[model samples]
Target chain A: MTGFGHNSEDEAEGRIEALAEMMARLPGLGPRSARRAVLHMLQRRDLLMTPLADAMHDVAAAARECVQCGNLSTAETCAICREERRANGEICVVEDVASLWAMERAGAFRGRYHVLGGLLSALDNVGPDDLRIPRLRGRIADEGVREVILALPATVDGQTTAHYVADAVEGSATVSTLAQGVPVGGELDYLDDGTIGAALRARRSL
Target chain B: MTGFGHNSEDEAEGRIEALAEMMARLPGLGPRSARRAVLHMLQRRDLLMTPLADAMHDVAAAARECVQCGNLSTAETCAICREERRANGEICVVEDVASLWAMERAGAFRGRYHVLGGLLSALDNVGPDDLRIPRLRGRIADEGVREVILALPATVDGQTTAHYVADAVEGSATVSTLAQGVPVGGELDYLDDGTIGAALRARRSL
Candidate 1:
């Protein structure tokens, strides 16, 4: 341990450590997982890591926030915005890119999305002015007379933001919130008191 | 849903789908996690994705398997092989590069390592000639080696390979297998009978 050590010549060690550290910064990966991922990449250098590196580099350089709707795209305006048919009198608004992706995965929603980046959090000093509120107001006036679907979270801040949006688009378009009910696989037993009450109130006869 | 869609101009969608597909190929990632990761990368392009891309590119370009020992390194011959001090007349033989990394993590062994790439498996048609066995024998003769520590798995194939290595280096160097027993925190009740017997046989008195 004392005499025969690999302390002086640790260049490869440093590089590997650096890669792991950076990898740990990504979501859903911590220090140990990141190290594991890096080691895995190192092993599959020609197959996995090289192609992944190229893809990331290309996306990093080309990908940008769509100026019109705040969705991510390589071009100036996102494909959804570039398409004339998507402006069919409805705009589904979501809080983040992840939420947008989820909606896309479902594919039930036919309209395009306006990713708000984040919810308006007074606690975090996030206000309407800080978000794309003004852009929404502009889009409503310009994108033709239509319906606005506020697919925001059920938090206090979310509700507050929804009310603000409804008020902003008061005269231009109709505003609707997602129905309050138990999720598809959710049991009534697991529903919170407020959710149960809201569901009961919104219940309709078959 | 039927009438309004972005059908003709689908370039951006294609790119996003391609990125998600690639992300899914990495370990610990599936279709869902891949989509989430891609959206996150697009969101943090300037901060996370760009730097990660750069790091991956650099590592992909520079990283290589050490010719001498089969450990992952940036150079042709790894730093561990280059260091004269690490050549302590002993080589810790492991099954794969990951095992080599695990040994490095422990920092117990002061000597260098030899990654066998895999164990000798008769079922899988993996023989000594298929592995780095020849290279290992060559190193033992040339590197002035005195001991060969078989830090291989306790599987049937692992034991078979260990015996083969021991016989190969019988006259020239001492061969020692890693000690087998219940782990440090293991309880006798939880341990299997074989492990308990191993622990009993390996018991060291204070």
Candidate 2:
């Protein structure tokens, strides 16, 4: 008998294979794990599977990066930017949208964010305009932003980008960064909320 | 100022919350990890998010449990049952649909399956009827089945149910159970294909 009792050329087979391919591309998932995950999702479709799919569809159709801050949102301006109360003369700069969300999850930073999209990488030929650094400079001057908090990684590339941004906005705004003891090679995404809060509370001058 | 610059109760907030809630219900996921997962999905919407959501939607709409064997399928009868060659007079019985799929992953067991749904459990008040025992009995008589291979867990309830099934089907057909070496408290879902195959090959009389 055929394995799985289904011809690979059949319609159902094609759909399953497609799903497996997509799942395999996700971080930490390989072909074998993807197959298991697909089967699991199929069995739990009524509860976990269906809702996950619907959420994905809704987000796919509506999601866009905030033009000003690079945070994922459905609008040109992210919700924080649109809120008048959030215009508190401060901006927390991060390397990615994931980091920005991490800060939000900690519930410690009440200031707005400026997503750099990525850190400067000479090996990858990335430069200032490659990120939103120019936009950040304009925001500091125009929006009366007083304090700039850098939450970039401790990696060489991240530090380079941090120093570059600090220099660019040096005279116009005060610059600081989250303190060390946040762990080496750890992303803000994996930090405990309290740890993040501590790092934010102990931020140091650049 | 709010981080990421969005109004607290905006459409984006609603969508993100919905996604996080659904993710939290997934196996091995909690509320905090679910939030992180949703944020990751949002950041990679173009590459990983959109396709995964589409696959989830398609499977949610089309997937259904095989009425005959309890395996997930897109039709009334699963592909395994519909295959003429797979109806080889031998039925590998399993406690749940997951074990059956695990067997299929091994590309062995060239026969049909009868998913028991769950094992008999007196403590929880589950009995033979709570499983697919009646349907299995009917299949033995109707399909000219020659063997019934039990691949249930090694739990107290699982073994008790196996014996009960063996006694019930003794006169009607040959009954067998997978051999030991399966870890205690381990579900067939977690066994490697090799272990499952070895267990199947070394099966003994019930």
Candidate 3:
């Protein structure tokens, strides 16, 4: 089996391997899964792969990050940033667009957003400047943002960045974070000791 | 947040949603995963999405199923069918190209393959004509094939088809199948009684 797809990966027929390798770069896929995906795509060209190719081409040709908030769009400003109703004096700061999308999925926040691109990583050489932190501080004052919600994760870097942002806009804007506690529907028996401790310490009025 | 992407999906900006839906059609993806994949692809255009688009385009333009055995390729005959050394008087009959690929992966089968497309299914209204049954019979005589190896699954339809092919070449060539017993690395303790019985029945001396 080694030589089956091997020779094809050689000079005259390396396209399939190249395609598989590129697919391996996708978030949840690896080389073997990539090969399966490529094979499936090849077999279902008219129904699945062609449309995917076309969609990617169109998006590649047009996709642009919102100049104001870093959200993805095909326009100068993303639809979220363009909506006047969303400009209700609050901006939710998120680590990346995926988190922004996750927040959007919740449909709880009515205000706009500010994508920080990534969490600050000192060891990996990723700093405040590496992300959109400067852009965010500028937006806080320029956009007349009243409250900034830190919808970042509970990781060390996430908390550090949250504190950094809170300090940056100290008196000008109130900074809040998503509640930290046992998730709804989570069983106490399965909860970690740290989570149980935190939940007990931060017991709510309810 | 749920309503944010929803409205955008409903409006004239339907390209991304359409792309996401098409991506959902892939083997292991669903709507939510598809949306994430598309969003990630959009964000990583230069480094990831563009190259993926290019590969998909190239594959879409060039990919063709093998004329001889239905394997996927960019040529009329797939690499295996085109290899003269692989014409070793043996033919492995498989139900699909994936199985053929798997057999090739084993690196044990040095002979060429014949893809039957699918097993005969009376429920699906599939007959021998629906698969490449006639083609197999023709190739056996034409190529002076000495043996036919049935690598079909251990399903009812698989056995029926295997027996059908065995009868088809009763006079000309010997017919065999992949062993019907415990797989390598499988624990006998975990195997079902039927498998254990089969293993006992087909026991060999060392």
Score each candidate by Cα lDDT: 0.82, 0.79, 0.82
Q: What local lDDT does model 2 show for residue A197?
A: 85
Q: What is the TM-score of each candidate against the true structure?
A: 0.84, 0.78, 0.90
Off by over 4 Å in 2: A1-17, A28-48, A182-206, B1-11, B43-48, B182-206
Clashing pairs in 3: A1-B104, A1-B105, A1-B107, A104-B1, A104-B2, A107-B1
Provide the DockQ value for model 1: 0.28
Task: Write the number of the candidate with greater DockQ, choosing between 1 and 2.
Answer: 1
- Model 1 lDDT tens row, A43-83: 78788888888888887766667778888776677888887
Best by TM-score: 3
In terms of lDDT, model 3 sits at: 0.82
What TM-score quantifies how close candidate 3 is to the native fold? 0.90
How close to the true structure is residue A46 of candidate 1, measured as C-alpha lDDT? 81
lDDT, model 1: 0.82
Candidate 3 chain A TM is 0.88
Error of 1 at A126 (Å): 1.4
RMSD of each: 5.6, 7.5, 5.1
